[model samples]
Target: MGADGGTASALEQALSTYLAHLRVERGLSANTLAAYRRDLERYLAHLVASGRRRAEDVTAEDLSAFVTNLRTGDDGGRPLSPASTARSVAAVRGFHRFCSAEDGTPDPAVDLRGPSQARRLPKAISTSEVERLLDASSIGDGAVPLRDRALLELLYSTGARISEAVNLSVDDVDLEVGAVRLLGKGSKERVVPVGSFARRAVDAYLVRARPELAARGRGTPRIFLNTRGAPLSRQSAWAVLRVAAERAGLPHEISPHTLRHSFATHLLAGGADVRVVQELLGHASVTTTQIYTLVTPDTLREVYASAHPRAHD
Candidate 1:
């Protein structure tokens, strides 16, 4: 017999080992592990309630059925979206893969196909809208005006995520070189070049607004501060964008992410390669960055429909 004895016994042992691996070796966050645990628990409960006791007894059809049930099951008879169903399917698949590899059983979940989810395109604002938003930041005079201008300019210039921008420190920005070092998802760092407009706005903020704000907290290294000298929070950054959008006569719902989308779309329109934008955006996969290409194609269609003779019916 192996370390855990029979195949059934080994299945339980393997699950424990896998969970430990996720916690220790992978260093998955508590919330993530909790989510995994919840997903697996629901899946196993479904399997048990359906009279499937052994992990080895699960077939691809059974797994697929579970996904289907998840999609259609509801307390009040409401159906789940393809996206929500996919996440549940992913969780079950992961559990079965662990079972198969560590317990020497076939991975039935591998053959079970997930639900097809419609690809939701990223919403990118037009360049004219972006220009209007930036212009709105400059309407107010004095320190807050400089701060708002710098905040909006930097956001569009770097295409940094809202979190990355607000979390920045003074040391992360080099105005002379027009580069800001961003700490992206998974704590990975990359340096992105800023535009002249952003650089000038930042310089003004540092020389004027920052000093005033920093006085409230002795001295903080954060690039952006509120009335207090402490660094700006993500919530505050979002508010700044919303206020600026309102002032610009744009929709009140415009967010910091809208500026990011605009930045990517505009860059692609100006002939920058998608791969380059992927690196600048700190996306791990080029596929994630390819969504911006859709924006370009859409713009081309609009241009063709509008400008070409005989294009419109």
Candidate 2:
């Protein structure tokens, strides 16, 4: 109610109510609600530090100022990205709208417009680069090599988020059927098909590598395990990806999501239906998967520029 109660507390209460609305009324997924919480928390922190403590007390001027600060201020002295700032503004605007309807309060963010951000396309690795990474993982001829090969193959084959791939259980993978059950964002379950290469790599790891690792501790159902037989963590997965990329002589800045992007891009380029790709990627909306169409257009333009008879002057 007051500044001394802390802006965080007030915001937290408001967010809890809003999140409930999102879950029960709007039927939003848990992952989406979690993102909203994170965004609102950052906005509340910014407001509190600037002396605007209460949601009911927020003015259009205060909201605008917060947007300006997000665009320009150093977050802990490091520059904030324009894209991140835009997402923050969107989160704030959504919160204000929700608050207005639920709490019957004046919405200060009604007129708040997000800053224009550059539309950068998702980065995708070439099919050849992916093959090279997978091959490089198998060079060492040991349990680590088998594990690395399986992990890389699964990532590219399934287009799974790194978190989902690392969190897989042995029962989730069906080697005979060449399918894997992935727990995606919001704990949504989707069965994604795996390629033969990935299936063979996983089979090798299960038969040879996993048993050796599992011996270090009590047996668990986790598909991927560390050297100590524990489930693989997200950080370790990332490190493994980076190491494989480096060994394959790929770019140093590549991330695990690059495989995901490549998966979608390649599928779209090969005439896979948008809805089918959406199901494979576990996207709740087709709009989220439409970004790949932009990539397709770019690819067409490149092809036309190179091959059209009248294009070369």
lDDT (Cα atoms) of all candidates against the true structure: 0.80, 0.83
Worst 10 residues of 2 by lDDT: 71-80
TM accuracy, model 1: 0.77
Runs off by more than 4 Å, candidate 2: 1-3, 6-9, 16-38, 49-53, 74-79, 298-313
TM-score of each: 0.77, 0.84
* Strongest candidate by lDDT: 2
Across 115-227, the per-residue lDDT of candidate 1 in tens digits comes to 88777767777788888998888786667788888998999999999888988999999999899999886567899999999999999999988888888876777889988
RMSD of each: 5.7, 4.0
Which clashing pairs does model 1 show? none
- How many pairs of residues collide in each model? 0, 0
